[model samples]
Structure formats: C-alpha cells, structure tokens
Target: MTISAEEAARRPLVSDEQIEDRVADLIGRAIKRKWWILFLDENGVQLPMIVPVDGAPLVPDEAATEHSIEGLRVIMDEIGAAEVILVWERPTGSTVTLPDRVWASSMARAARDRGIRVRAQLISHRTGVRWFAPDDYEGHLEAS
Candidate 1:
C-alpha cells in the first residue's frame, strides 16, 4: 500500500516524547542488566569501570549520526569468534544508532587504527547515552 507523502509526514518522526520513552526503556534495561557493557566508541571498547559512567560527555559523537552501517553488523564485529557473547542482559538491545552512532564509529575507526579488538556499550543518562567497555568494567561487570 502506498501512503501519500502528506500522510507519511503526519506520522510521528521520532518525537521527544518517543525519544524520552525509548531512552527511559534503555535506562530501565541498564539498571536491570546491572550494565556490564563493552562500551564500543569509535575508539573501541573503553575500560569496564568507565562503562557504567552516568555523566561526562563523549564529545557529541559524529558516528552516532552515521547511516551507512547497521548496529547488528557493528555488534557482530565485536563478538568476533565467540559462540556466546557473555554480555549483560537484554543482549538484543541496540540503541547505539545514527546521530548517536558517531561516538562508537569514531572509536571503531580508532580501534581499527590501533589494531585493538573491542566490545563497546551504551549507557543512557538524563541527557543521553554514553559509552563504556567490559574490559574497564572490572569485578565481574555482570551479575552472573
């Protein structure tokens, strides 16, 4: 079925209310998961301790706005050869996206240059989600 452009435009194109709701959902997951994330920025995965970080801006990442790559692809690269990626709960969570994708993209490029294998993650705050890494998580970043 072909909907008219006018009708399509009328559709909510990511409203603040929607964004807030989405972010809130992520926050709930973060709390429930206990946030043992692999914080993959354009710079690759950061230290685990820094993954759960609530504040401290990440430079309004340019990668966050990227449109070429898919989140699942980025995730697969991080998983490497692992059969099970021993991650925090809700393993299907993939909010690391465009306009928010830049950070991870930059870190990913950085990791590529540095030849560092990484596993990055996102942590949402009142402002927005930030990056973190399981390597920096320390002391069993996960509950299990």
Candidate 2:
C-alpha cells in the first residue's frame, strides 16, 4: 500500500513541549559557544540567561584587567535557575535585539494557565567573577 500526498499533509501537530525541548537543546549548544542568549517573559520583561559557554583563554592574569565581556549578557546567572537574579548592563548596539521571545510565549502560556499576570523582555548572559554573578537587576525598567 502507498501513502497519498493528501494523507501525508494531515500529519498531527507536534506538542509544544516537544518544540520547547528541541529549542532548549539547540539553545544550550549555542550558549556553550560563548554566545549570548536572551530571555523574555510574557509581559515583555527581559532576563539574561548564560549559555553554558566559557570565554576565550585569558591572555594573562594581568591582561584580564582590560577585558570585560559582561556587555554580552543581559542577565547573569549560573544558567540553571528558574528564578534568576540579574545584574545586566545596557547593550551598546544600534538596533535593539529581542532574545528568546519564543520561550517567553511558552512561559506566558504556562503562567497564564496558572492565572498569573506576566511581563516580557530580552535576556542575555555575562561572565561571573564571584559566586555565580549576582542576580541584582541593574535597571528597574527597560529603556526600550
């Protein structure tokens, strides 16, 4: 027996959890490359998530004083917390970038299901020098 194109087109939709899981896997890889991945909630609130990436080799302990990669992340954490504490600085790029909106949508959906009001925004990761980078949110409000 042969399957028809019309029948093939009727395949069932994938579960949201499946999609989210796949994204998590790929995103995990992306972050490990020292790339910044941002997170936003439903209410447009931004949160920074550090991909499990390590920065480049230190040129020297003395040279380290000059380079600060903190600018890369919007949020700072160990990258394994449900509720992250942040200490992110404003980005310098001309165009404002939105990161992890899909995650926000999923989060919002989950939150709303539990009858919770929500916010959304971009999230990025930064280096931690002392104790998992304090989750102290630098700004109370997002400028953009």
Q: What is the lDDT of every predicted structure here?
A: 0.34, 0.28
TM-score of each: 0.28, 0.21
Q: List candidate 1 stretches off by more than 4 Å.
A: 1-28, 31-51, 58-96, 119-144
Clashes of 1: 34
lDDT of 2 by residue, 11-108 (tens): 32134332233233323212232222333333222333333324533121323212322322223223322232121122232222232222233333
Measured by lDDT, the strongest candidate is 1
Question: On a 0 to 1 TM-score scale, where does candidate 2 land against the true structure?
Answer: 0.21
Candidate 1 vs. truth: CA RMSD? Answer: 15.5
Best by TM-score: 1
Residues 11-47, model 1: lDDT tens digits: 4323334323432433434333233233223322221
Q: Give me the runs in candidate 2 sitting further than 4 Å from their true place.
A: 1-99, 125-144
